[model samples]
Target: MLSEGWAKVYITVEGDSGDIERCCEKKDSHMEDLSLQYVNLEESENLERHRTEGFSSSKALVVRRGAPFRVSLQLEDRTFHPKTDFLRIKVMLGSLYVIIPVTSSKKVSSSSWNAYIDPEGLNLQSPSIFICSPASASVGCYRFQLCVFTQESQKAYAIGKFILLCNPWCREDAVYVPFEDQREEYVQNDSGLLFMGTPMNLVSRPWSFDQYEPGVLEACLNLLQVSPWHQKNTRLDYLNRNNPVYISRVVSAMINSEDDLGVLKGNWSDDFKQGVHPSMWTGSGDILKQWAQSGYSPVKYGQCWVFAAVMCTVMRVLGIPCRVVTNFNSAHDTNANLVIEEYYTETGQKLNVSKDSIWNFHVWVECYMTRRDLGPGMDGWQVLDPTPQERSGGEFCCGPAPVKAIKDRRIDLLYDIPFVYAEVNADVLSVIVSKGRVISYSKDTEKVGSLILTKAIGFPIHQSITGDYKHIKSPTSSLTSRRSTMSGDSTLSRAGSSNGVSVSLTLDRAQVAGEPVCFTVKVINRQNVAKKMKVHFNAQAKEYNHGPSDAFWETHGVIKLAPMEAKVVHQQILPAEYAHVLGDNLINLAVVVEDMDSQERVLASEEFNIASPHLTVQVADSIVPNKVQTASVSFTNPFSHPVSGVLTVAGAGLIQGKVNFRVLSLCPGGRMEQHITFVPSMVGTKMLQASLSLTNISSTIRGFKMVSVHGA
Candidate 1:
């Protein structure tokens, strides 16, 4: 018989690692000795567990490694003696397990995990203790159990599960991020910007990461549980979960369904009746929830940006700092030759002769972590793409490809560093073909990686990070700081091999949707004699990722240029001629010159994006939590005809779920204003987003406003 009102609790974990078991086994004997003479363990209470772990106001029990979190233990029997009874905690993930003694006298290795009874824990009817996992603990869902060991007997009680993740806030963690502000923005901010459109006409589109939302964290954990890596080899996956490198690669693969039963099914075709269009998605919450609730079946549609943004959410939810990045003129070299070959006719018409592609802007995520697998100095931001463009290690996922290796051209490293290097550094080989033969060809080494953009820290604007990817200096316009993708001045030029004639294309200015396609073709003759040439000007509508379709507009004319003469021919294609053919709001404009005498053809082409009309989201600068706040959405029809569609509004901390309503019809250039109200439930800087999607037009307009919420 022992003292009353005392209960001993212990948590035990199962694992194949004998080192952990030996460490835990040695501590258990010490704990048994402490039971012979009891000791009261106490620790200072911390109310900011959720805040410090960046999961405040979130529903899941997500704590970072090396951080302590509390678990309340309720006992059915209370008549136990403190000297003869104690507690043990058991936590298990896959085959790795450990049994932790909560008493301070049995303190185990600080390099692993530790537990302590927080002040009279065993003396009370309901015991509350602090569980602290070492910085090296594997990241995943851990099954927590509390077992009572009394002098007479021992019994185990099962409790709920908690998730452990990498700790960017812990100095001892491998994923540690030193700065407080960057940690907040990268790991905590729920919304951000995704740069799209062309480098000349950048679009700062908004995206809701929805990482802190309820069920999102759960879904992220569930995602890992359902991944092929975890399903095929749980032991290896669980053991490697401690390394961010392996976790990121698995997550990148899980973001698409081509290789496994993953979260999203990528759709790049025209028909989307079976599922939602890629452009209609405003946030990752709906996509992730749909994936989890539907028996892990992949969600309908997602593109590069959506995949990257969703991966960002998963990385952030797992406590790894992440951000979405866009590369203008991103190349996809099909043959691994480090060059993308493009063929065009003498009449400025693109020929589908190569497997290569150049996306106007390709989006992916950059996760911040130390790359122990790739050696030192390689640590920092590593590019991870979930678009399923290429398969690495026989799986449809790419990278943790170190950005440092990319800049230094160190392709002999692990992951997909070579693939990523070619994406930004590939040479563009433009060939002119006439009569089933190559007339002339030109290579542009600097064209593929013209711009790389990411959202600035603590601000909604985007800044150029191009220099980080490419070591060499860029063109004149590449260095200018960009707040909005609104500005432009990039030029395009290609010529015949050492010929006397040259052709170049330049945009008078950035072209916008619903406006005429405007640009000029300059032809120069350096020969000492006059020459007559036939000019072929062509315009074709294209997706940012695919090659140009049939030419929507074309013209042929004769021009005469004397020696030391330069000519600029202005061209325009009306909105009526192009709006119907646009599938992805992008166009390929080209002009080819055929020397009437020499028959040598020269080509110059420029790919430009027809930017969508901006959707305006406005709300009060400061909103009170738990109080109703009004937000307004404004949009003007940029088409030639009346347009109508659905308008969706979403917010993380500002609104629950999402609100959708039918938008009234609006004529060309007609403006529509909508107001909606919702009561916020949390305090912080939150994004209020509205998206206007149309069924007829191929463009989606989006807007987001970041507002500070006042605490109640």
Candidate 2:
């Protein structure tokens, strides 16, 4: 298909070798120059291809082995469809000579083919020849045939050739050109269109790895060809927004209405429903399934995105424009309050969930709903989540009434009132009401009606009321021995007179038979006068039926002060059992007036232990040989408190063995030391626990290390 007049060839010797003579011939328009360097195998026995001019370079063959060797080929680029009609390469060096004939078609695209030299046969004096290209091929890319021969062989020793021809299935877009291009043109070719929608916050150089691979490109082309979307009048924009939801809902509704949609529709297979579930969007899979069976699912239905997507699909089907946005915010919305306790009771599990902890992830969705839901003049811009029935549902809507919304409603009242006390059939006051009107009211004026209140009610009442007016004086009713009101005094309980109602309490854990428990007491003012408030504290003895005579505890101290002026009463419980360690065991403490008129009065409890933690060392195990195979040490905890101690091993190769510890510290540089450490002597695994005699000691502890060795 091509003439020799339009072809040219060039070649040069390559590698560490002498040149082999073989002049290139140029017939008319075809110039075969055999002078340029040709790439030869750097190492013998290896194969390599050589290129010259163009002509889709050809592989080299060792015609004659010498210092320098090269390849020869014919090149042609006249017009686009050009080909070589015939090619032959001859080699001669010293007494060596050979010839090769080539035949080719035009379909092969690569520029070169490999020619190998046999390591055993090729030598400095051996002669070889190779013939390639210029074959009876059509106008297309092709490989040339290569033929090898030697001076002694009459018929061609080896013959090979290749050719390429045009194919209708070739991809024009996938073509690559390595030769000619301007710098500006090259720059413009590399830049692709940038995505403009959405926030392009991150910018970086384009990546080639993400480019469609050969297989992917072929698949895409096949898909496009099958659908013929360009010729079909299909609404792609509407399809993009509505297709997924239509499929999702169809799948969901089918699943919900039938026990087995696959059975109803025989065409459906089990594999198609592998990952599908009734709870489509619930983050927690198990919880959703459980709730789903209950007829009213919580978590699954609460997934705002799922509902948002479904709703968006519905809206689009109805010709409405909308978009979905997802984000996380605190429960309190703006202030980010981190200390609100929310207990979920629907799941029948009572857990005090706190907003302060790290689990405080509040997720919600936003959608463009009707604007009238927001406010006036903003009727069509209401952004909210469709799943409003969820736990933390809907977008944060700070409407016009924000001033009246209190985020922290739990602590609105300083104290909670579990119960309140009131006067009933007491020699007290009475109030009469008629037709929702207070007809009459009266009291014992001087004394308040008998009121029995528990701590729950007393605390809140104390925090609510400071200066009192009349305990039971009323403006209307005549004196009576009973009281009448809308809410009867049925909730009240009789607590006897305030006098002689003495309650002596102590920290049970801090007190033992022979130990002293430190505690404080405050006496508030119930009367107006600066009366001397007599205070007394005594440790009552244990009642024993067969013991000697009963002894009454003597009052340790007393405080006298004016009315309304509170005094701190410090006391302790002293039993005879701890007499040996009473001096150290006595929890010494003094009551300080930390709060004056403060409703919140906190008492401090101090702890005193009689024993201190100390470390004692003992060689746990010894082996038969003086040089032990693996030695181990154990530490025991024997103190009333926790202590931190360091154990160190000084012998060499100490760090080479397997070392483990629970209480000992492991140091570097073979300085085998640990708050705990383990050294294995035998060739077996030993389960060992290292515990230190920990004590809350203020200073460095003294000796007390107990060790016990057990066989592994």
Candidate 3:
């Protein structure tokens, strides 16, 4: 409570390690440092008694990292008299973060307050905060304080203050951060927070889309940013050419900046990460039919390229941006068919293709999405070539294996499908591959070879669709950014072959200790003929503990594999085996892949790991619905514990409010349902959100989703 014409405001900063400071407008400033760490403002200088004619101070001083930065003013209380409808506080964070407007635990009953920043505003690049006091006679010269905290942090970090003055000039000063005209686009007056849209209608696809017009050929430049081909081409050719003519033609035909669709780099989006499968694009359109009939993988001449392009195209067309990636799995034994050969072995012997030594090029795509559904339009990836069967009867079949040593392994050449192949080996003669016949190699293999072409292959459509999608052009290009498995670039000379060969295994880490030990095995093939090999592994422990080891490391399954193929095995060490090895423990691991024809040895190895478990945190059911919305906000602990902490909700005009709850005391691992009743005066269609932390567990962070009121 204060005099008729006087108002008070509070300003605070949490975790102000760097001493974030803000200058106040009023010459006389009052500073209250609640943290007790230090107080910068003297108590007597609290109010700037003399008001400038306009009642405006220089820009309000504020420390960047300081919390609760505030100011108070002396005014005629008559200005805040009756008919006052609402009290509001505006908040803004200089940087980007999800801000939550929270009120002080100490309740002020006489005045009502509404919030500005809503849940939708949380999605903005950076948003401000707003608190509105319900306009009423009790508002008098009340102190309206604004508290803001990041979504990641439960506690308030920055605080601001203002006086609820009844005078008109005083009210204008509170809303000064953003001009009144811009408020519609950036914030709501009642809550002083941003107005983010609804969850189903979240804002994405940059605002630039709104300004796009057909007249601006430069709009075509948008392709340059979304499409990788444009990015590279604009760099190599159009870096200086901003001419309208060039933009029109390039944008009109949508000619990617790099190569044609059939010969593009990769299809995966830039956001793709490990463990996720790449997307595939296939359609029955006329353009796709023409491209697929050309002995290509429907999109490009190379399977890897086609896979990459299709993956990328699907993601882009669906509004997810992506980029092509290129890398060589030199230490990867899982993908040998993609290896490029390297000539001149360690012994100075010309390299050859054997079942045990080979490498081939490969390609795959990746992406990231708000949700885990596959594909843009609920339709996920459909198969064009259903029931695809690999060429049988050889060291290389459906799995990783030598290319030349296998009969009918080349899907492009073996089928009546138009195919292309280049011989990089100087010793490779003419290669004649026929179905059911071992491929015969001659020195003339350097000559360009074309296989029969298969056309009009049909695919079965998957009934299950996931994300939203729109039909665009069928993928008709190949992404070539991935490295060639066969690292060999040597030009072909006279034909000659050697039997000398060598193999090596590279592990992800030489040392690792944990409950689950995952590592990769890199197998290099240094031979000529397609070599069929077997990799065998065994672990040696001190006391021969065998419970979990028998279940996980038993050698019952066959390890038959291709040359240069690497495999990453995730091994979870069981609790029983922990006693056998202590510090610097040694264990033997072996890999053995044999040459199918000669039945000769290829690889053997040893590896080890230090085993231990680490504690981790995770949040469950992040999207919880607000079932009952009355006097008290409530939620059930989906987990098996007595979750105990504060639950919060913001949005749809709730700025400064309070919620009371009765404990349901549900049994452990049981459901306890209850109903909530809020003051009927505060009902609306806007989303009401709340979060209550009931568990002390570090991983107990919760998210309230699908929030709705009882009547609304």
Compare the candidates by TM-score and give the number of the best one.
Answer: 1
Q: How do the residues 37-120 of candidate 2 rate in per-residue lDDT, one tens digit apiece?
A: 122222222121221111122232221111122233221222111133233444332122333333233232222222333233
Where is the poorest 10-residue window by lDDT in model 3? Answer: 203-212
Candidate 3 lDDT over residue span 153-248, tens digit each: 111222322222211112222112223322211111111111011111111100011101111112222333333335556343333222211222
Cα lDDT computed for each candidate against the true fold: 0.79, 0.24, 0.25
Question: What does each candidate score in C-alpha RMSD?
Answer: 5.0, 29.6, 25.2
Where does model 1 exceed 4 Å of error?
A: 1-47, 50-60, 72-85, 105-110, 119-128, 150-153, 474-498
Provide the clashing-pair count of each candidate structure: 22, 82, 157
Candidate 1 C-alpha lDDT tens digits along 1-712: 4243223444333344443333333323323222112211221123255343335444335667887776655555354445556677778886677888777544545477788765653546555678889888898888766666654445455555567888898888888899988898898888999998887778887888988777788899888898888888999889889889989999999999998889999998888899998877888999998999899999999999999999999999888999999998899988999989999987889988899988888999999988877777998999999999888999999989888889998989988888899899999988888898998888887678778989999999987778788875535446352212222233432333246888777777777878887777778897898999999989888887888889988999999998969898888888888888753568888888889999888887778887777789889776898888899999988789998888999898888888998987889889999999989877788888888888777667778889899877
Winner by lDDT: 1
Question: What would the TM-scores of all predictions be?
Answer: 0.89, 0.17, 0.21
Alpha carbon deviation, residue 279, candidate 2 (Å)? 34
